[model samples]
Target: MRRFYSYLIYKLYTWALNGSGYNTPIFNVIVTLACVHSFQLIFLMFIAFKCLPANTHLSGWLNYVAILAILFLISHYYVFYNKERWEGYVKEFENETPKQSLKGKIYVLSYLIGSTIGVIWLMYFMSVYLFK
Candidate 1:
C-alpha cells in the first residue's frame, strides 16, 4: 500500500506540476484530494451495507466533514509532514523498464476511473434504495 501510495503521489504531483504550473502546496492538495476520494468510496460503501440496528441517514455536511478528515489523514499524513518521504517517492521508479512503467500507469489510471465510477454508482443506488 505504501508503495502504491507513493507512486500515485508521484504520478499526480508530476502531472499537476506540468498541467497548471501550480506551486507545491496546490499540488499537495490535489494529491490529497485524490487520496481522499479513493478511500472515501470505501468508507461510504461500508456505511451502505454494514450491519446495523437500522438503515440510518447521516447529515450530509457531517458525513462529508468526517470523510474529509479521516481519509485525508490516511492519504497524505499532513501534506508537509514528511518532505523526505515524498522526495524518496518522487523518482522511486526512475529505473523501471518501459513495459513496467506503462503497466503502472495503467494501474493508476484504472484505480482513479474505477473509484470515480464506484462513487457515482453508489450515490445513485443510495438515493434510489437506501435513502428511499
Candidate 2:
C-alpha cells in the first residue's frame, strides 16, 4: 500500500511536470489549473452519484460510458501534447547518438497506458454521478 501510494504520487508529479514543462512558471500554473479542474470534476461527479435515485442502473451505466468517452477525448489531447514535448526531450538527450533503448520505449508505453486508465477512472466516476 505504501509503495502504491508512492507510485501514485510519482505519477501525478510526472504528469504535472510533463504537462506543464519546466521552462517557465506558467507551466506550473497550468498544471495547478489542470489538477484543480480534474479534482473539481471528480468531486462533482461524486456528489451527483450520491444524489442519484434508485433503479437508475441502466441510465447510470450509459452516463458512465459517455463520461468515459468525453474524458478520454479531453485527456488524449493533453497527453498527446505532453508526449510531443517528451519526445523532444528524448531527442535532445540523445543528440549525440540518436538511439532508442528498450527502457525508453517501455516508459513511453507505460505512460500512455497509465494516462488512459486515469482518464477512464475519471469518466467512470462521472458516469456514476451523471446516471444516478
Candidate 3:
C-alpha cells in the first residue's frame, strides 16, 4: 500500500510537472477527483450491503458523498501539495527497473479502469432500484 501510494503520488506529480504549464495544485485536484469517483462506488456498496447502516434516502447519500468528496480533496491535496513530500517519493522510486515501472503502470491503469467500470455499474443499479 505504501508503494502504491508513493507511485500514485509520483505519477500525479510527474503528470503535473510535464504538462499544462506546471500547475501542480490544479493537476493534483484533477487526479484526486478522478480517483475519488471510486470512493463513491465504495460508499454506495457500503450502504447497499448495510455496512454503513444508514436509514436515509437519495438525498442522504448525496450529502454523504459530498462530505466524502471534500474530505478526499483536502487530504489528497495536503499530502501531495508539499513539494518535498512528493519529490522524495519520486527519488525513491525513480530508480525502478523498466520491468517494475511497467508493472506499476499496468497496476494503476487496471485499477482506474476497473473502478470506473464498477462505479458505472453501481450507478446504473442505483438508478434502477433506488430511483424507481
| Winning model by TM-score | 3
lDDT for every model? 0.66, 0.50, 0.66
Q: What tens-digit string does per-residue lDDT give for candidate 2 at 14-67?
A: 445566436543344335435544555655655665666657546557677578
93, model 3: CA deviation in Å? 0.8
TM-score, cand. 1 vs. native: 0.62
Clashing pairs in 1: none
Error of 1 at 51 (Å): 6.5
TM-score of each: 0.62, 0.30, 0.64
Off by over 4 Å in 2: 1-21, 59-132
Candidate rank order under lDDT: 3, 1, 2
Mark the regions of model 3 whose C-alpha exceeds 4 Å error after superposition.
Answer: 20-22, 45-68, 123-132
Reference-based lDDT, residue 76, model 3? 56
Alpha-carbon RMSD, candidate 1: 4.5
State the local distance difference test value for candidate 3.
0.66
The weakest ten consecutive residues by lDDT in model 3 span: 50-59
Cα error, residue 116 of model 3, in Å, equals 2.4
Native-structure RMSD, model 2: 11.6
